[model samples]
Target: MSELENTFNFSELEDDGLDIAAIFGDTGTAEPLPIPEPEPADAPEDTGESAPEAERSQKQPAPEVEKKDAQADGETDLFAALAAGPKEAAKPARNDQKATGQVSLFDKPPIFSYGGAKDAIEDTSMTFEELRIAKADDFPELAEGKKVSWTVEYGKTTKVIADPKGTTIASIKEEIEKSRAFLDALKKAKEKDRNPDCLVKPKVTAQSKGIAGYKGVFSTVEEAKRSDKTICLIPARDGRVYEFRKTEMGDFIAPKDNVIEFSAVRAGFTPALPLIPRDLMGQIISFFRCFMNEWEEFEALAHIYWDKEQEEYTVFIPRQRVSKARIDADLRGSALPEERYIHYADIHSHNSMAAKFSHTDDQDEKATRLYFVVGHLERFYPSITARMSCGGKYHEIDPSLVLEGIGEEFPADWLEQVERCESRSDTLLRKKDFLHAFAALGDMPEESRL
Candidate 1:
């Protein structure tokens, strides 16, 4: 008997998850191990064997013990390979059992959370207006002190691509003007409601008409009216058309009311601030009367000033070269006021002639300023006239516009009842020949305009 067989009993293994079938791999029904003929006690046992068989028996005994030891070592190695199992990849399932192996923590999908830091939450979930109108309490992490310190972004925006010269527009307002757009929309709505569109198109007509070599629409009455056509017709709208006819005096004549058109607008040196305590005109009148002479006439000069620090209108009598007709003063010379004081006007006396601007006055008073002329000093109430010189152009203004105590209060309704009556007059020059730039307001008669 083999010594290894005596040491281990093959039938005494416990069923403790050890795979004996795996250790001893796939022993099929074809074959079992060949046990060599053991060495006989005396001579080799021979029945009717050949002579070669007897020779093999002598060599077999020599290696019989060695063969048993080699087989025992190979079987022992099979038990050691049990834990390693099969080297081939495992099949998916056996007996409908689930396949399982060592699983990684990262193998499963990550669980998203909205309760972490403010930055950890995704911003793509909210829209632009939603972020603008939403409050801090609307967020989960930022609400109820979930985190003491956190940051959120809404007003600012990051560019999808970096640009060096990108610009953003921001609106600024002193007050929250919530209803301005609403008011404009309401006005447009009201206009549309009141005056809906006039869907009917206007009737347009084209005709062949010509006269006096002026082929199209006649600009003048002579062209529009021919020998056969005694009168000219025109499409009339809401306006006045003055008919100027050549009179015997070789002048185109029209009503004075229709010819003269003007409107009142304030210009250089309007009386906005109050005058100083000293009455400058009264002082000038007193000084003129105090130095009145019956011989030749002399002129005096004064300038009106406004002091920024004092916010008052003052008068300074400047030294000048004066005569009966002319008075010249160095306005911007050494006698000029300081930078804080603004020179507003220039006034001079004409001694005794009517308060009218002479040719010399227009030539000398070219600077932009208010000008005043006092005349008829011999009378109890001297005459005064006020005008503004705007860049060499002159405009006559009411004396009360600048001079105090020059007019009296009157009822407003009296203007409607007043009527101007004068004799007929004509000019030697035509209206086109003597035309200058002037504001032409619409024709507003006393009855309708008042």
Candidate 2:
């Protein structure tokens, strides 16, 4: 403190010779004061307007000022920033996230496995009649009153049983075995004597023949001519063929050669020889009768005629076979018997129209046409009546060809009209042109149309 006072006294003495010690606090008692240096004459004045030289020197350049001004004004210097700005740090990339839950790659759901899915099991507890009754209850329409037989399978042994009295389940099983054996034997015998190209015999009775038998049905005298292969020669009974061609009422002349006849009856006729059990025979007869009745209903709805005595539902189509050989050839690949005439009643059940029936050479295009025709008919006549009355199995006539025939026979514009009436698309055909086309097909046509 004494040194500090002495120094301060000296400094004050040098400055102005004033009483410095009295004006200043004691050095030991108070902190030393900071004295500002006296202003020099050479020092620049600060009027609060001009910035210091050093500060001016450190300020941003004119270009930088302009750039800052531009940025503040929302103007970006993309290129300049790219050249001058600090480079961005590169970021690390990440891989795709995987599913979290535990999963089994090859695990499969459990499925039931049966030891014998289709193999019939033997139940010695029940008799044959009980089994038949059970089966009949299951398929009452097809099996009721129908003789049923059974074959019981025990390990590797099979035992046949007959149910003549329809009494017990055990008897039914025995009959089933007998029936199966009989059928197998018959099948083997037929195979041994089978003829690959043999023609099928017709089913006709003598009572159903002759001009007197077909009296009012024949349109022309020639149609009445009975042939062994023909059912009945009748003119267009329903006038469908006459009307379809747009022919005049009187222009349709009855065809002399147009004959309808069934093939010969099967040779064996005895009740037992037929091999069909009485109960089964009743069922078969009922089934056929129902089929025929339904078929007639269908025909009547379509305005087509069904001649019961003739056993034919005649509808006009463009083509007919000249010989049995031709018919066989046409039906070579068919599932139906080659020589047998397929009844309209059984046609839907057999799904014959939906089947492909063309020869191998034609690329099976006829199947598509057949499907179209069936679909068309189904659409128009959705009812059972439509199915029966639509008539004819594979009329075998091309629609386009029929159109051409109609064009040539009627007014030139008629063909165009027919074309316009054809279905635009199969889906639409069901509701639109189906019934019209079906009715048109049934209409009578001029002779020249064929």
* Top candidate when judged by TM-score against the true structure: 1
TM-score of each: 0.32, 0.16
**For candidate 1, lDDT tens digit of each residue in 225-271?**
43233223322232333333333564342322332222344554566
Candidate whose lDDT is highest: 1
- Model 1 scores what on Cα lDDT? 0.47
Q: After superposition, how far is residue 348 of candidate 2 from its true place, in Å?
A: 38
Off by over 4 Å in 1: 1-270, 275-278, 406-450
**Per-residue lDDT over 52-115 for candidate 2, one digit per residue giving the tens place of the 0 to 100 score:** 7646644543544444443333223222322332121000001101222211111111111122
Go through the candidates in order and give each one's C-alpha lDDT: 0.47, 0.29
Residue 449 Cα positional deviation in candidate 1, in Å, after optimal superposition: 39
Tell me the deviation in Å of residue 418 in model 2. 32
